[model samples]
Target: MQSIRSLAARRLRSSPSSCFTATPASALGPGSARFPMAIFAAQLRGIKASSKLQQESTADTIEYSKLSDEDLNEGLQRETSESGARKPFNVEYLRESMARRPHRATYDFLSPGHSHLLNIALWDALPLEARAGNIPDSPQSSASEETSISQFFMPSASAPANNSDHELPSGHHLVYFPLQRPISLLEPDGTDPAQSPGVPFVRRMWAGGALDFRRPQNMQLNGARAVCVERLDTPNMVMRGGWGREKIFVDVVRRYGANVADLDPSPSMTAPEKLLALENKVWDDADFEERRTLVFMRAKDDVPEEDAAEAAKKPKAEERIIKSPREPEYSFSFTPTPTLLFQFSALSYNAHAIHLDLNYCRNVEGHRDLLVHGPLTLVLMLSAIRSRNTNSQVSPGRFIRMFEYRNIAPLYANEELRVCVRRNVQGRAGDERSVSEPSARWDVWVENNRGGICARGTAVTHV
Candidate 1:
């Protein structure tokens, strides 16, 4: 099979007009007369170049050159439908694709190393007071000993063979990342395209998510293997700002449980049958469940020259700001640095350019700087709740049972942001809280330095 580089080269040689023209020597300045022709000859002499080289070089080339004709047509149909044209949107196709579930389950080991590294990264990002009781006192202790994660690494007899001593933390499950796509398969924005609603709706953002620790004790750090079964709900169309601007919201549900192989052994089953059985068992015996809402919208090209100048004149941080109305009973402020963002990205195996690439964030996403990851904010909220519980004598043994959160706005790196939590009454009248069960509800949010809430959530805890 011919590589894309060879195919591009062959096409360029066959169609010189599509690439470039050999400039006359008289058109060039002194000492650079033969530069263009020489480079052109070099490219023709089997010097490999990317298929996108010519397209990227030309100003008028279509931005969606990577997409197939069918994909382009589908996107065009959606655009026309949004514009009140007779062509209807491809609702059937969207429903079929988005609602499909994975055929096989993905597995990951509950490695202590993953937990330890995440703990270290979170410790560095936390304020001094938040890290006060969490870390050990001895300066001479090992790096692992300085964080609470060290306790999980200790040996436990009851732990699954080769697993850690303690159960995984509330939000530490983020570290057990999903399957990653190879660079060749990733979108231009450095995101996995498997779940994307194809073509023009390529740009994706983590809009919000929820976590339910139904049986948290089942997931431990003992190096035992666990399985995750994922399925996507039907996509919902949302109108944003004006009439022709549409966004697609996709809800991804993942259930984590012990690997079925370890629990049951059926040698007579075929591979596909075994996988189906495993997925069914996981759904029934899941230790915890996570649902992430991702929003996909059309990609924005660079602003035109005339508008670019005007946009440059305005301050990057001069957008609308909405402050939180509820005062916090506990708050911790810390600025996320580039290193912290990079570390978190690595821990989560998230290659989204918004978190790791500053240029992509500014030039493509129109952000002031690198954006803080949605999952990172969730982790911070969990950390804040854990810290509050650790310091309070009333609920020392309380654990987070359920958490629901939404991302309201973007939070930039190197900006001071505060994680705030306010305690609320346990439950409604005649509910579980009205009984002897000691529980609490907390309103948790993260606000920027200007006191604008960027992310907010609610957490329910039980003793």
Candidate 2:
């Protein structure tokens, strides 16, 4: 095995044609160098470079730190007044502004702290380009319309990004897969197969670092920001992150009901001198970390010590451990179906292809099969509650909080994963004016046939 020093020297000594010196990121235009693809790439490389490989390649970057939710809120309080609405969502702008700082992986000292600031920058910049192309052949078409991106992603050509869209390396990829066939997911219900939702838009880069946002609004929004950064790349690798989920959830609820938006609008201001006030409210809010105890299924050989410890520690979950005589919360455990995964990806407007394309997920995100977003568990629970309780409804507006959910295991395809909730009656019981009182504070958890919890939590009800 070669040492990192030797590897660096070998790569550096290689033909100039083989190795190129990267620019100081600052050299690029505002839009040229956006987002921390470089840092993420660094993380991936650092992980692969390790010997044992016990830790995750990417997740190691978040400390989530010990910051109380209120403390986290305080970090966002308007540091000063008149923080004008000057280019708030441009990834490039955010990058350029942030470049001046030191960089760090975990939040600790952050060698410098500009990584996530530009996270949502591109979402605001990716507008649907008209491109002034030749009129379409179809009679239904007008002068010019958006370029439809069904399954292709054209890489950008901006000043050469670090993570160039090149062919997969020898061992990095499991196999080359064609973008054909639907990825495996739950089977659709013939009875109520509503339109599978989501903007399967690909955020491809152009030759000169340009991108076309010709996708639909719901397909994309001001809340998105992406960058194929080179300055942050290692030798022959790349990394990138999307900024639509948070925006999508917020946008969807606002579309359905603005009242719901008020619950927790992270970055917004009012007409009154409440701009700072509004920011402070979020900055000073509590629950810096919203901890939810979840249950997930694991193979008999795969049950984790963390899960075991939690189970043993709170064996019966008596009234002593935030106890409640909440009904023995039990919910449906549908077998994994293709229809479910597709519906979820659509609802999320994510197009990395990992979620739908099991092959892509295994190839890029480097997961065992398809990985489920922790939030999806919450979604399934919400869906079940809606189906079981005839009158209970989900109101996004005035809906105030979620601290955080730590996923302890993966819910593989085809496996039956349960979602259960047994809430504490005296907790923050919701809807002071609801109809039924079947224990608003319910204890919830989902387990597999092996008796392993797949997802679990306590949720309030709005009758």
TM-score (all chains, Cα) for each model:
0.70, 0.31
Leading candidate by TM-score: 1
lDDT of each residue in 431-455, candidate 1, tens digit only: 2332665667888999997898888
List candidate 2 segments past 4 Å from native: 1-327, 363-366, 386-404, 427-439
Relative to the true structure, candidate 1 has a C-alpha RMSD (angstroms) of 17.7
The Cα local distance difference test for each model comes to 0.61, 0.28
lDDT of 2 at 26: 29
Show the lowest summed lDDT stretch of 10 residues, model 1. Answer: 17-26
lDDT of 2 by residue, 94-135 (tens): 222222221110001111011111111111211212011111
User: Residue 1, candidate 1: how far off, in angstroms?
Assistant: 22
